[model samples]
Target: MKDIPEGCMKKRGILFTDRQQDTLTIAGLSLQERMIRTLQKAGISEIFLLPQQSEEAIASLQSTSGPVVCLTTSLLLDPRLIEEFLDFPAETTEGLLCVVPRREQPLFPLPAWSAPADDTVPLPLFLCPPPLLPLLVEALQQGVQSFPALFTYLQERTKIRPRPNEGRFWYWVRGPGDVKEAEDALFQTLVKETDSPITRLIARKISLRISRLLMSTPITPNQITLFCLGIGLIGAFLFTIPHPLAQIGGALLFLLSTILDGCDGEIARLKFLESRYGGWLDLLCDNVVHVGLFLGIAIGLYRQYQVPFYLLLGGLAVFGVVASVATVCYVTLRRKKGSGPFFTSVVNEEEAKRLKPGFHLLVKINDLLARRDFSYLLVLLALLRKMDWFLWGGAIGSNLFFFSLLGIYRWGRAL
Candidate 1:
């Protein structure tokens, strides 16, 4: 049952006052502040702000003429706030509302208020449930827009997945019942690409060709691993050359290596070629080639300039190698233990359903990366080189640490 009048939905203002003096230590302030901004953008004008005080509560509402809702942290878990609103003249109380954190016991010892048995007007005694942000906006919109259609709309749009761009754990940050719109945006993009004939033809054709080649050859996954390693080394060698043509050659070689990386896997899968040695070899080759390719480029550039950038370039190479090694180790460990690989899951139909309507078009945005392997690393390396050496190094360091922990945990679990 709702605690507010069903018809009064618009012209609503939510008063957000925090008990904590220091904003820095507030656990979820970043998320709460984001929510506040979202509300403001929705055009709710009068957002009353105050430190915690029982007496000023009423005065706060009196100052705002529109419907007023009180938002307090756990410290303001007082029931009298609700009783005070109930005691006010019904017309004023009609717009007064209080939102408090949930508790095991009643927050205030005030007398309980009740509606006449048949009265349909809801009271303002809602609990400020944690993680309710997603649902709150939708619920408010439904209740405000149409009371009868609220439940139906909610049932249809209840479950949501994280946006691809938001990375991981995005859902945890959203208040309960709120959809991660950023994720939703990406979903839409992915969906629109489903209709592109070019994407379907290319994705299928490449995948099939690779499969057939693998079937015809006795080339083991280890050999595929070696092939990629050689390609990557050559790419690196080309990168060290001083000419623009050499750099272009290096990029093309790296791209070819990336494409072949996918081909090997397709061949293996199509030919029923599966082996533990192959998987591990693939992992080893990935780190070797990627690091070799980037390092070759960095050293090549250094040889040309002979500048202080040698250290920075070297740092990127070392850190990038460490990061790739860590990520591969972690992923391998996770796979052995039947756990998810960090940062991504195997794309499937379930993922397809979770995608938003407008964003799926991005799937067909082809590049050298549109295949089975981790070619995304190459692009990142290029961008990092252009942007800043420190950024490149930092990205490598962070990725290593992040994936290392996952690997360690999975390794422990395996034992």
Candidate 2:
């Protein structure tokens, strides 16, 4: 969750009128509470429950020298929407900013910018300056219980502008059917632009199902990461055995570990538990598993073939992996300024142009290869009972990969 600091903006949210379905649950948390959490994560300082709020609460708003976000309890807002809306200075741009649905479907919360607002409908969500706080309190006290009625009262006083909706997700959770739709909308957010084709097409399908099962449970995202680490370590250890069956089993476990890796992120993002520490921890755990895998495979191969060179190759592979990973972590953690989920590598064509023209093609190919899709290849090699082939490739290819990463880092300016 990204927080907009108080010095930047006084972020406060208020649900003016309460609805009967305020307790309606979505993904184990109530719809209202989920909305509150979303607002708070977006850096809301104070959230007010109007009509039911104490005199102190009303007194607090009178002193606000900044904007306040006002919404109804009936709708479940998208976090993206709230964050974007906060960026617009409703206090100065317009006396008030209200986001309306498409004229065709007023009940739906999502709308295109081209879709004109139908004024007959009420304001589900809006933002206003502190000067209008008295009107907001008066509306509720005057028995403007319905959104449509409240919309009229506000419009009569304040100059309201209909803002465009920039988000892909949000739901009007008024009933039981709406609750299911809201949950589905939230799940759709797990899809990301950075997902590899293998993870997107195959692994994500399974991981998302697992995430759904664990979503409502008491288990946290960090807990899930540790559990997967244990499973992956066990799988890595299996590669130390000389037998083909153990090596094959280890490969399968490594692939399983790759699939399970998707879950921690999904859980973290869904619950707004994403942090810089969590990001670093996840990346570190992955590198640790990779180290175990490379060494274990080399040890197994050396034992089976009685070759001393395999041990040397393993040492080189480990060194390359560590060097490459250190560079990426250093760039992402220290060099990069702002954050979301960090993009480790896989530069776009334009970004690749920073390097030599010849390197451009290799960078494109490498970006495609970077998507963790290689786990599928590993499983395929294990099925053929040729684990040495993978170790051989890992030994040589790992070093080449490291050099390519080094080149990219050295050449790129903004990376």
lDDT of each: 0.42, 0.71
Give each model a TM-score: 0.38, 0.85
lDDT of 1 by residue, 1-415 (tens): 2234334333333433433322321122333343344334334454433323322433333332333333322121122233333233333211222323333433322123222243222222232121332343545433323211322333344431111111111121122222234323212222222323443344344534554445445666568768878987897788677666676566667666765665555444323344566666776676676666656666776777776576465566567566645654654564453211122222234443554443233322211122323333444455444423433544464355444444433432321
lDDT by residue (82-132, candidate 2, tens digit) is 777777644364544444544454463322222344543333677766556
What local lDDT does model 2 show for residue 30?
A: 76
| TM-score of candidate 2 relative to the true fold | 0.85
Q: Candidate 1 at 303: error in angstroms?
A: 1.6
Candidate 1 Cα outliers beyond 4 Å, as residue runs:
1-207, 334-415
What lDDT does model 2 reach? 0.71
Q: After superposition, how far is residue 297 of candidate 1 from its true place, in Å?
A: 1.5
